[model samples]
Target: AKTSGGFAPFSHTVTSVTHHKGSSTVRALSMISSQSTSAEISWGIPTGSEGRKLRYIISYKCVNQLACSPGCQDAVEGRLTQENTRMTLSPLLPFTQYLVTVTPEDGLPSEIYVGTSEAVPTEIPSLSFRSPDRTNTSLTVYWEPTIVCSS
Candidate 1:
């Protein structure tokens, strides 16, 4: 305290502090089950950014297709929380390669490549007798279905 003659002047100084959190990122993504027309996937929760809730959006695209129409580019969205990080993507093309993306609300997205299982043929051709065309060493049989890899 300073006094001028008989009076004193008082003053105070205040300091401000701020805290910044670290950036977050996706940890891992694994395939739970992948079928001909549907797929289930799960991922690990990210770290470093605490107390901040994030939403996860899942999307996929076919590797062979030119467009994202059939691969759920914008259709499948997963709002997964910290504990729940699993989702199922369906109505996909069979026997096709897909690039799956898991985008978090805080940081950059993580990607994984997955392939669907082959579909079974719906049509079955009847067996025909061709004994006259069989050779001494081998026999020839023919059964045809046009949709080999329709997707």
Candidate 2:
């Protein structure tokens, strides 16, 4: 029998239903360019996920963790919400390797390895003059290497 509201009896009708959404994931990550202290990257989202603002959880860590001071080597993370595929990470150490991961909301994360370029030397060189070899017209001088010797 139908009730006044045209509904079945409470005991005979469905009370509630839960619908599960499909799972999507970040598909790809690529490096666009790099500088001495920054990196620009791009990523791909799952098909059919375009045009909608998506929140990305971005995290990065230096591959050479030993280079940083203790308690300062933790991974850096940030959140961004946009429909575009490009973003920039800055204030990174020069000539270092980093592992970057981007996880879109409700999706699996994509990871990539990136490297920053070497920066110009910032240390001042130490110069010493040899008095024994110095003359009015000629002089001998020695200078200590300023930048770290990578060779």
Candidate 3:
């Protein structure tokens, strides 16, 4: 406090504080299982990075014509401990391409990892054809469905 010769002149000085955001760091994503109509995804957080009540959001889209359809979004909530972080997307189209990304709460919008899902086909039948006469101009075709066919 400061006082003048007459009475007193008082003044106060106040200090203000502000906070800024920190740098962005995200965990890596892993593909657990990929099926004809479904994909299982997983990821992990850094050591000592877990905070209170953390949540995850998984975003995905058809990246290739094989499974290309439209973009889809899903989310997982809870804290992760000894168990591996996992999630599965099912009922997808056969032989399609998909892109998936995982994002955590309090994480930067751009600090996320993107991964691709495997292309699996439901068709498992194989066809075989042979002609009776190799030298004959006329030919007949026959097909037998085999159980071991992959695309």
Q: Which candidate comes out best when scored by TM-score?
A: 2
Please list the Cα RMSD from the true structure of every candidate, rounded to 1 decimal place: 8.6, 5.5, 9.6
Write candidate 2's Cα lDDT for 1-151 as tens digits.
Answer: 5888797755766689774343376776899999877899997776667766677777787775333444225444445565567888887777667888887777777889998787765557787553347788987677765544211
- Cα TM-score of candidate 2: 0.65
Worst 10 residues of 1 by lDDT: 74-83
Q: Against the hidden reference, what TM-scores do the models get?
A: 0.56, 0.65, 0.46
Stretches off by above 4 angstroms in model 2 are: 1-23, 65-83, 126-138, 143-151
Ranking by lDDT: 2, 1, 3
Could you tell me the lDDT of residue 103 within candidate 3?
58
Per-residue lDDT of 1-151 in model 1, one digit per residue for the tens? 6576765676787899875543455787888999887788888767865565667777787675312345433332233333357887777766667788887765678888877787764545655554335788987786543423343
lDDT of each candidate versus the true structure: 0.66, 0.70, 0.49
Tell me the lDDT of candidate 2. Answer: 0.70
Q: Ten-residue segment with the worst summed lDDT in candidate 2?
A: 65-74
Return the lDDT, model 3, position 79: 26
Instruction: Give candidate 1's TM-score.
Output: 0.56
Q: Write the per-residue lDDT of candidate 3 for residues 1-151, one digit (tens) a residue.
A: 4446566556687899874333243456666777666667766664345663445655666444433323232222222222335777655544555656555554542222233344444555444656444555776555676432122
List clash counts for every candidate, in order.
Answer: 0, 0, 4
After superposing candidate 1 on the true structure, give the runs of residues whose Cα lies further than 4 Å from its correct spot: 1-23, 65-83, 122-147
Query: Candidate 2 has which clashing residue pairs, if any?
Result: none
